[model samples]
Target chain A: MEKQVAIVGYAQTGYESDVDASREILVLEAAVGALRSAGISREVIDTVVTANNDYMDGRTISNMRLVEPSGAWLKDESKVEMDGAYAVLYAMMRILSGDHDVAMVIGVSQASVFPTYVPGVMTLDPTFDRERGLLNEVSAAALQARAYMDACGVTEEQIAGISVKNLRNAALNPLALRRMPVLTVDDVMSSRMLYSPIRELNAFPPSDGACSVILASSKKAAEITDCPVWIRGVGFSHDSYLTERPLDKLGSLKQAAERAYAAAGISDAKDKIDVAEVHENFAHEELMAYEALGFCGEGKGSALLESGATKINGELPVNPSGGALAANVACAAGLARIAEAALQVRGEAGSHQVKGVKTALAHGQTGLCAQENIVFILGGE
Target chain B: MESDGLQNVDMVRIPAVPVFNWSVGNFMERFFDGLKGGKFMGVKCPDCGRVYLPPRMICERCFAKNDEWVELPPEGTVESFTLAQVKVGEDGELADLEAPVLIGMVKHEGADTCLVARIEGPDPEEASVGMRVTAVLDKSAESILDILSHYVPR
Candidate 1:
């Protein structure tokens, strides 16, 4: 028999730049918010999972920073340096294994403290790539964007459509960092181009923020909230270590999506998935994800954007909560995706709410959208 | 009792230090040189028309062995980037760097890979995608660390 996992509580700090709080203070704020939201005390949490990178924090063993603030001083704590959703998935497995009943997963990134270019600098392989002075994630995405436009015949106008829609949705989200006046297709086209086919408006701004979620077993979930979102399925995959894969294909994400659909008993994703929260730090990536996640037929992702099928009022609304494209906090991105999806399922997504969001999908990508992909399926109970 | 004054002491001392010799190795050595020279470099897998930046010894996709070096153009655009206000050293010391330093990935021209580097221009707030920029190579040194230069938009 499979074990059941549910999201009992969740909390997040509004995405922003230059948070006045210290790292410990940030952790405490999110942790306390989650506990209060769940109507539970700290002692109820059986295990703790944290997501952060030592390199990002400029410290070795960065998990030590969470000891006091996260309240994991003497409990079972595990640090996942990868994506936060991956950490949440691990927490689910731990509960499924009967090792624990309640778990708290926290993800934070105080990037505002570092020099702006540090991440791009650190992303280099440090051996071969750093020497060649390679560009970071942005550049990698730009290459993919160019290749995608060439392969799909996508126009700059179509790419901007995604930005316009996301930004419009962001206007409704108080936590969104990039809410702007009504933007036009021309505005996106006219925006400063960071790479060919990618404009400044097409990417998410670097925001420093933190998010935390509380997971509980079925029984505990019943006691916690009236609207507990069930984790029907979870899947994660990693592609080839290098960025040399077919640009049009997201092999890892596809495989992970398939596994997640299978686990959730989903036969047809496009028809069943009502809402989707995808991690698209770059604009074109949103289109690529449409193909990779089986939301549309391969090579027809441009059509999905063209038809406005992914808009807030479209057949399948994507990123209704402004998404990573509006407010991107690196380590917290994946968890934010999951948290947003959970909010939709719980009917708690204010202002940016999508209608009839019964079953939602949350997807995350790491390492140039080529490796380290995760997919989670959440449903209203 | 007087003879007991001739007592002795036995002691042993051991000294150990954390090995901190972190080298960028040979493959990285060549790549960094290319950066300092204002050029981007990649290793091509002759078997499959794939080029890897921060050249890899082995191809990730085809598992093909890479032995040839290829130079890439320095011109590219920003893909995605984050500005960091904090700077951290290897020893976990936070450096008082400037408030916001632009760091992002630059897709090199005619290459399939993107390289991460520092963004240096007249105005960081003006940094955006599709803004034409060239890699300012460091001419003073020839190591991975030496590839330090800012991106100036054309």
Candidate 2:
């Protein structure tokens, strides 16, 4: 919101259940791909920001292996142990500080290397919650889902419908992992249930992925590309522990969105934004996000989905790149959302591209049941 | 980069299990002391009157030091629950449990917060929200595990 920063280029890998390449190579590919796409050499990059979780990576000082591949070897660099969207926010801030002209943000995760939900459980209060040994990410999500469905009168059928829509859209996304063009609500409902309301298909598939985006000051952006997606506004917020807050509400997302909207000078989000890329770890989360982002009234998310308004060709298409339900690689997920939105703004999102996307909103989240939320508003000049 | 199966394969199994000694400070020490006496204790915020099932050092809402400790009633109502198909071990890996378990969030009587624990006394599928439940604690216990196994429908 200070000095202007714009996303000049972005790239991401084809998300798979398991990538054959080493993480360093995967990171190098993404970092190099972005530089090539921007038609700029790494010499111009004044800083590099890497996004990853050390706990998830199973090591301390985790980015040491990735630093060189990320093109951060001799440059001013930092890391954010959160979703990639937050990493982009950090890069934008660095550019805005006038200390850096161009900053490349790279984020990655390999969910297959470990039981994906274990690290999530470790995030709970180790003194009691971990000692109790009953809750994990899936179980916590079940609690949130049940509370939300009970409050809103949402049904399992409606939750499955969300998966059907997103997975269906994924068929057109060459980079997504779960591309089921013929996936039906019945198929989704019949999937192995992880915890009651959360079925295997209803949750994000285990994926390995990396994504990169280059953020630069307005002057550097102008030199990099003719079509730069300006970072108009950004916002982020976090809620208290599971027991302290209302389980049915995504209060943090609403708070973050309000801050983002205020900074972007948008009074009516539904009319001003042309497209949106929401990060949903679970199918039910998308419905919750629709309400939290103010796209529809609270407890009316199911109705919003049923109205077919969020479809790829719908009034305000959301997750045209299929979203996390198709392929979620944790830290890489949020950056992928921003990259997909940028592609839409640049008219380069191949098969899933929306028409005339002047403004776009990208969302990212972390913690159990989306305890932390970040929103980014992007615009095309 | 083509692999010739066994010829190119080399493996090292360096499995590790980390152990840490956590300090359960004075606040949690008191709760444990209360648990050893066959009673459940919780912290009450003097300013807001909000009671935490697991005693808190400070009020989460008002940020006031919770100096008052209260005896939590054994009975409570279920707020939400899940029937877990799998369980995780101390090493943070999924362990095979013999049977599926019922977990619930129970808002203890006279407490503003809920406790997450195992549930019993009803079929997991039949464990409905708002069901009345009570803590089943074994008084002759050295650990929290023996102190409270699960909550049963009252």
Candidate 3:
């Protein structure tokens, strides 16, 4: 029989403007919370996985900060510089492979702790792209957003609707930073425009937060929680990093979602999935993701949003916990998405709960949707 | 293994093209002037079709060679854009530039490439996908970076 992997515990620090706590302290707080939630001791964790970027932290070998807090000082700890979902998936793989009975995955980013533009500046290719002083993530996404609009006819108002909805949802989430009393589509439309087509409201606030999840094998999971969210499928893919590729479509995300759906034995996600938490740092991306994830036919993703199919009370609620667009902390955004979905399946989500969420999908994307996509499928036992 | 000072330290004075000095005045003067001057120029790729705006010494895609200089058309479309609320220097020092600077990817007409530059003339909100923009070159500058700022829908 294949080894089963399940998420037993999850914890996250409330998003803040500036976390005065040290990086180690942040990790420790999350680790302790997860341990308490899982009702397990530190000894039960057989291995560790951490997701972070050195550029975000302004240090080389940034993983050094997690040694003590992650309980991996001398344990088998692997570091993934990409998204947290990648780390979570890797942890699941390790637990299923029988090399580890229990695993802990942690992701943290303190973008607000560093200089505002440092991470963006660091992302530039030092040789060529950096010389031109490209305005980091925002600029890259803007390019893709423009391309997407040009090719797909996605209106700016429709994209703004995503921000309005997510921010409105964030108002109900205690962990979100930019919650408002009332958010209207007009508010999003009138919000300060950062990039043409992408407004300040459409973009995620720079936040400092940490999130963690504990994974266990079937045997270990049985001892941890009766409502473990099983990791049925996981997929990751990367495409050409060069900007020369077509910017209109996310080819890599499509492929990764296909692989993940196949692995999960999900033939038709639209009918099978109960909830989805996609990484939409920019509002228009949520619409694009609908097509890429096969939630709807291509060019019909916006229609799904317009039809209220992805609302909290809709057929398939998306981002019930306020997505990255609400409280994104870069490295932690992907893992947070998975954790939110897992919480919904475990019936542990408070306030922003989705009814009968049995099957959930979490997606994590990096680098202007140029590629480096990860997908996960978690189902209630 | 013996340690020789010369072995670890190889000094090379490679031939280089100074693209733009890290100065707002210098960048604007060079880039804006390049656009007004009509003759569109980009750092040529001796190896392929890849072109670099604000010109680079090497091609990022292939890393093969980038020596041939070419004059390109000044027209392109707005890819995506943002209005910056703040500006800073290389050393993290704040610069005295107008807040909410409009920046975007300007894809040269009929070219397979795009560049990041200042989007001038139109309101940033009015700037949209497929909006036609041309290089507003400064006539006095010699470097390509002097003429890189993009102008309104033409």
Alpha-carbon RMSD of each model:
11.1, 2.0, 9.1
lDDT of 1 by residue, A1-381 (tens): 133899988888888876656667777888998899889999999999999888667667988979788889899998998778889989998988898999999998876765444566455455544444344455556656766776677777887888888888889889888886497889888876554455678877877888899999998898888888899887788886434455556778889999999999998988999899998888888888899899998889889888878888888999998888888887888899999999888888899888999899998777764467899999986
Native contacts present in candidate 2, fraction: 0.47
Which scores greater on TM-score, model 1 or model 3? 3
Q: Which stretches of candidate 1 lie over 4 Å from their true place?
A: A1-3, B1-154
Q: After superposition, how far is residue A296 of candidate 3 from its true place, in Å?
A: 2.1
Tens-digit lDDT string for candidate 2 (A155-204): 99999989998999999899999999999999999988777788889988
TM-score of 3: 0.81
- DockQ in order: 0.08, 0.53, 0.16
lDDT of 3 by residue, B1-154 (tens): 1234355534333344234444434423443455565755556677676765544555656866566556678788776565665444654423334666777667786555567677788876676767788767555556444444456678
Off by over 4 Å in 2: A1-3, B1-15, B89-97
Candidate 2 - CAPRI tier?
medium
User: Which 10 consecutive positions of candidate 1 chain A have the poorest summed lDDT?
Assistant: A127-136
User: Candidate 2: global Cα-lDDT?
Assistant: 0.87
**TM-scores of the candidates in the order shown:** 0.76, 0.95, 0.81
